[model samples]
Target: MDQETLPPNKRELLKQISSPHNPKEESLGSSSHKPSPKPFWSPLSLQMSIQEYELLKEDDEQCLRKYRKQCMREMHERLSFGPRFNGVHELDSGEAFLEVIEKEHRLTVVVVHIYKAGVKGCEVLDRCLDCLAAQYPSVKFCRINAAVSGAGEHFSDNVLPAVLVYKAGEMLGNFLAITQHFSDEFLATDVEAFLTEYGLLPEKDFRAAGDEADVE
Candidate 1:
């Protein structure tokens, strides 16, 4: 019988055996796989010269200095309130209140009222401050207990209900005995007007988007 008349499997085996074998193909399919070529090495990659090392060291120092300066700028931005102040916050201790005046006052206008307990004048001002705090979120309003605020005896007698204003860590205005200016029956508007006269409280924000930056 002719090879073409043989079964398909036998025909294929005979054809492969009669064909010339390829050594390159056999090696490609061998048991062990070939490893990749090694990369060329440059002297600069292996070891640095003394001058190069010094230059690298200088570059590292300069980079470190820039990083430190960036961190400090971020810290200043966080403290400076590039944004304005929020609502009122009560200080837990005298130290905390002083810290705010020393560190945080630089950011925005700080209004601190030293109040004594059981004083009708202080209570009236406190209510006024609550109203203003809601209206003017940009100004910081705080109240401290005169007795517990480490203020000397002088504050207890004379400066009860005193409103101290600060901007940029400097005392701008000190209004003592606010009751002398207005009676306890005064409303929030009265207190606002008084503070506005001293440039403590800004005008009411009537812009459409109150939180947006005002365009020039």
Candidate 2:
């Protein structure tokens, strides 16, 4: 009985059975269900061999010796201002790093140091670093290698190439600076907020970012 198909109801049933609702069908679901890329500032271990470690240790000693030889009074600097992130510390099992949580909260600043392979870390590096040294020095500033780790977990690749401040073992929670680009006022606000939280500064009227830009 081929009268332009057996009947309307029968034809519709055949179509429904042959073309079932397919998950693979387009526009049937949310586009944003895909996972986000990890933060770019994820912790990474700086790779080095035993000999390299020895060399660094020896070199640091030599620098101290030179400082001693050159001056009658020892002039000091914050050479290792923040937690040493040679990868060993940042990637340690959760238990081992718990000590940091208890340690008095100092500003733990992580600078997502980015440099093209074969590039030198010099003046230009300092230019970008103004937000750190001038704006957020009260925090202990450390650095991490960004190019090596770009996975998009909040602390990994998603913000790749980001500068983050952590305090009391929580990322972003105790932070003042979380990005590479910031205006002076924005930086000042966060720093002031952090300093207040730590009771390092008074309750009001602090100097702001680039206050010295005009002088220099």
Candidate 3:
């Protein structure tokens, strides 16, 4: 190989083969060619993301609940088919009372008040029923004198100011001497609450009651 490095190409190959290998240089070269790793999410950032997701989920659930309630209210309004009566009616004869109870709409709740003219709480109950009838237009409120009911013997003066609730031709409740449940003086609200407690009245429709009041 001493012929002035016999040939130019051969001399160059011999020189590369004679050079020393460096592990550090090889490692540096390999590292420089590698692709960088993606950064990891911090713990705080991960927790915050979870909290944000939970809040959004809760918001969606709340919206869904509100939507369902709105739909139910609309359906209820559309399905209500009962007749509305704004004031208490008076029955002069037992036959008329029977007709009202048997011939009214099946869904209608009929409340009858039995009283004698001079009974202690008869007038007060009458006034309360008038107010209740106005508030609950879906219910039919009626009043009949004990003597006029043709059952005067059964409904004596002692059991005056009685209340009878009927629906679909079935008696749901019968309360004799109903005034004994209230104080000497009571408001329409008292009667309404009492009836509601006994499950005798339906949910109050404030919207309809308000509209009726506006008309008057």
Candidate 4:
């Protein structure tokens, strides 16, 4: 195309070609035409410096450590003392049984041994509970004479040595004549093992007691 009819870009190219070639001048011209480099710090990086980031990360780690320590302290306190129950109590009337299981200790677990006066197994269970009561003071242990307690209607000669476990006013376990399930010679440890397996009792105390006994 004629110079006058050429496109603006072509006209510019022709002018560059016609100009005298000087390596020093060309190099300087090209460097000036190149785009300026980006700044080292972005807008976001300027907003949050490295020191601020480090401080924030450190605060978060401290909070996490504090929360962990608080949790561990609370758990240790719970395990140290646990729940407290006086030794085995003998219920005299139906009202007394109701009070122990429903009203007075409804929020706690109540283990009741229903027994007849003549059953030998009942005697063994009573002794075992007495020992267990001392070992686990937080768990309520009691006995209701099948013949005299107002709950006599729920018991009979066939149901002697029956054990009922209640928590929060609900029956969690109903073991009828558990002596029949184990040998007549079974002890409190056997009863503890059975209850632990059912998740009714925490197992840590048993292990801790064993450790203490071994050390002694």
Off by over 4 Å in 2: 1-126, 147-159, 173-216
Question: Of the pair 3 and 4, which is ahead by lDDT?
Answer: 3
lDDT on C-alpha atoms for all candidate structures: 0.75, 0.42, 0.86, 0.77
Tens digit per residue, CA lDDT, model 3, 91-154: 9999998999999999999999999988899999999999888778789999999898988898
Ranked by lDDT, top first: 3, 4, 1, 2
Candidate 2 deviation (Cα RMSD): 32.4
Candidate 2 C-alpha lDDT tens digits along 119-170? 3332243344455344444344433343333422344333333434356566
Highest-TM-score candidate:
3
Q: Score every model by TM-score.
A: 0.55, 0.26, 0.62, 0.57
Question: Where is model 4 more than 4 Å wrong at Cα?
Answer: 1-83, 105-107, 204-215
Backbone clashes, candidate 1? 0
Ranking by TM-score: 3, 4, 1, 2
Q: How many backbone clashes does candidate 3 have?
A: 0
For model 3, the stretches where C-alpha displacement exceeds 4 angstroms are: 1-77, 208-216
Worst 10 residues of 2 by lDDT: 201-210
Which one wins on lDDT?
3
